[model samples]
Target: MEEDIAEIPHYKYYFATFKELEDKVDQIELLSDVIGVVTIVQDLEKSTLNSRITSCRNVTIKNVENKELQVTLWGHKTDLFDDNVLKTLEGPVVTIFTSVLVKKSLGKPRLSSTTSTLFFVNPNIPKVEDLKTRFQEDVKTIKFLPSAITTQSSLNEEKKENRKTLVKLLEIRPKSTKDMRFTVKAVIVDICEKDGWYYMACPNCMPPVSQADVSWWCQKDSFINKSPLAWYKLNTIISNQTGKMRMMIYGRVAEYLIKEPCIQLVTNHVNQDKRKFPQAIIDVIGKYKIFQIAFETKAIDNVAICKKVFDDETSEATNNRHRLSPPINPKTPDPKVSVNQR
Candidate 1:
């Protein structure tokens, strides 16, 4: 058997770069092979799939081009990664994943392992050695920074000493049209169903896409020959005792309340009445949440966009106790606040 395998011709390999895979992120008709230097390996996680629990893990890989792509290993594939051994290995760890299908989660594209997928780490192959050499050369010129989420959270904790009421939030004027981030405590007073509950989004960039004949199209990429993903684009009125603000709760923030993927909701909603909002969305009407809102100054409309949503816990008391610091420009008006009737 070993002799027979050795006599077989060397398999012709075609590896994709991070850029190519990202551009056709919504395409899964063909499987792909990817090679990169292992930069970050996440812990094994478990989730329910088809009524059974399954294990998976994600690792961030960087190509010689210094572009990062996340590869997710599922089921038995997760065991192929020897975490302890990889941690102890010296120099850059060249890893390869074969026969992966592209999938999108929360609007970001990632490689998902199929049943035929193979995992390799530092294999005795010429391609890996060449990649390792190039990656090592590039690493010298690169300065790594902390993950964006970690950095943003640290900055928010530093500057977000107090949460603002809707009234105070409206009082502050931005220096420019650039979006300003703020944390607020508010209750969902009503769900705005004017534009329906969700949108068909481009799987790569998460922007709304329209169906153009057989293909889905968006302004960013023109026509994408891939199925668009249904993502949450919830509009609602949120209020504290001070005032109410029209807010847009998008993507995962809306998913956090709906407790289901927008794709599933879209499937069920296709035949349903178009005038009514999904029950899952309606259920959150009276719920209170701590929202990290982004105020877009360029828009003439008075709507606060929600970036992150948190559970109302001890933060509510802290919000009421402390006042929002004066705006960036003290000349900004501090208008008398009035509560809006629900």
Candidate 2:
């Protein structure tokens, strides 16, 4: 059996540029093998199918030629780049994904990993190093930052455009979006983990960043920055009357949900215990909220898009809309402010 396994032919991978994938979107007739660096990692999709939960992540990769490609991975493959796991890559890296189907969804071209798809991350290969070098230079020129959610006005406009009708959390089913987004109403049940609710990200690309010997480094962007910027990235388990699942709230929405800017939160928790979360952030365990979602082809789940938190009280505090916005441009962290990069 061991010899038989070793005898199986390794599939050949053809490094591709996003330009080669443009016309191939929206149809499975053209399958591809592509390589690039992780620029953005969107939230996991909230769904369980085939008796197991499959989560999806929306990723943007910069190819060797400096072209960007959107790749979606569903199911267990999403774990390949989890916050802690990808750090093992130890520095900047690139991904080589094979046998993915290209399709267009939500106005963007999407490449999804199929059952036969296999992905190699930060592999020890010469071509991968070249790709990493190219990715590093690309980050220097591009604003590789956290993804921004649709603003209230834009979301309202999309609704006016009549994209899709709202649905309950329990009503979500496999293969529902047909490459469209979803909107649902739910309530917060509990926080998943409070310790790392906010992460220090590279000021360039906002992937969970870490400290290196001389400067901070971003694994996804494949480069090192002078300092790190703290960003709000939360994963909480929420529910409707019928069902519950984990969802992600990021950047601006996270500030709105937590009611605290990430800059302050990180300042307060720098030397604190890792197991405890601030009571302020913990107080929203029972609030009702509305959300918009996009399909995660990898997890076969959906990522929460637009969010509006509702409170029971009729007070002015309850009526205030979220005022925080992601910076129009990435800002360098103040040199005086201490960043806990462990």
Candidate 3:
């Protein structure tokens, strides 16, 4: 004799945003399902590194209850329908693969489906509020997936790594502007570590000279005397194998790197020793050229000079070539400042 099996009733669920569905990851079973509307569809082709390979389509669907979830279709599913399918699919019943695993990032849980996961469209799902109330009751029985929740251990590790990579200075070439053949190097001269930000000054301007505000004035006869000299802001992009990041450098740092206020050449006499200014410095301004700047990551204990130069000119040039100071000692106060009584 054959045994009779009972059929399970399909429960209706609704969600408005992706966050609502995240907590329900544990309650869903392999055969459990949901009905929702397709809200967004993005092309993943550009995300792929290779040209010859095609990528999957990432779709974000919102349930009748306004719950949002992500769906990725691979292989044949990519070409199964057009915009018409996307438009019509917004207001109906749909079966989702609940057996699929969840991927967690930054404490958020995201659903991941495999090739075996299936989806079927049904035109009869509840329209709005009615679907929402039904889902609220059903969510009570849903449990939180242990694997989906981000643990404190993982978050601590992430924070530790980020602390090490806190960028002091970033360099990038500007787009949409003419390539200023001049290479710009920004250095972080001061930092408010408490605020998680640092101050940069242009290398050319040096420190004390460039650290002026609008009120401070220069006495030079040229433009320096006519207008208030202040530090400039630089915007650029920096990237590595992991990804690209944008940074903004301001104040003294910008002035130091661009050497904006510093004149490049001096005048000399043509026949005798009379002064005749050379244009070499002016011509090199904003000219694009390649140069490298080294950043001191940590402190060095001792210095050993392998080669010694007795000539002043050669020694000065050599010193300039390796001109980087050790990290500032936080505990040491500047000796130039005199203590004032209250």
Which one is best on lDDT? 1
The C-alpha RMSD of each candidate to the native structure, in angstroms, is 12.3, 21.7, 24.3
TM-score of each: 0.61, 0.41, 0.28
lDDT against the true structure, each candidate: 0.72, 0.61, 0.35
lDDT of 1 by residue, 124-171 (tens): 788778877877755432222232232334544633545788898777
TM-score leaderboard ranking: 1, 2, 3
TM-score: the better of candidates 1 and 2:
1
Q: Could you give me the TM-score of model 2 versus the true structure?
A: 0.41
Model 1 clash count equals 0
Q: Write the per-residue lDDT of candidate 3 for residues 1-342, one digit (tens) a residue.
A: 235765454744432245445544432222233445444556433222111123455656556546666665555555653434544433332434434444455566556554555564543444434554545444322111111233444433332331212132233223311222222222222222232222222222322232255433222321122222233333333333233233344442333434443222111313221122123212222222112222222313111110100112223454354334566877766677677721
Ranking 1 against 3 by lDDT, winner: 1
The candidate with the higher lDDT, 1 or 2, is: 1
Structure candidate 1, residue pairs in collision: none
Off by over 4 Å in 1: 5-15, 22-33, 37-83, 87-92, 97-120, 123-162, 172-177, 315-342
Q: What is the lDDT of residue 250 in candidate 2?
A: 69
> Residue by residue across 204-238, what tens digits does model 2's lDDT show?
44677766777776777666644566676667776
Winning model by TM-score: 1
TM-score, structure 1 vs. true: 0.61
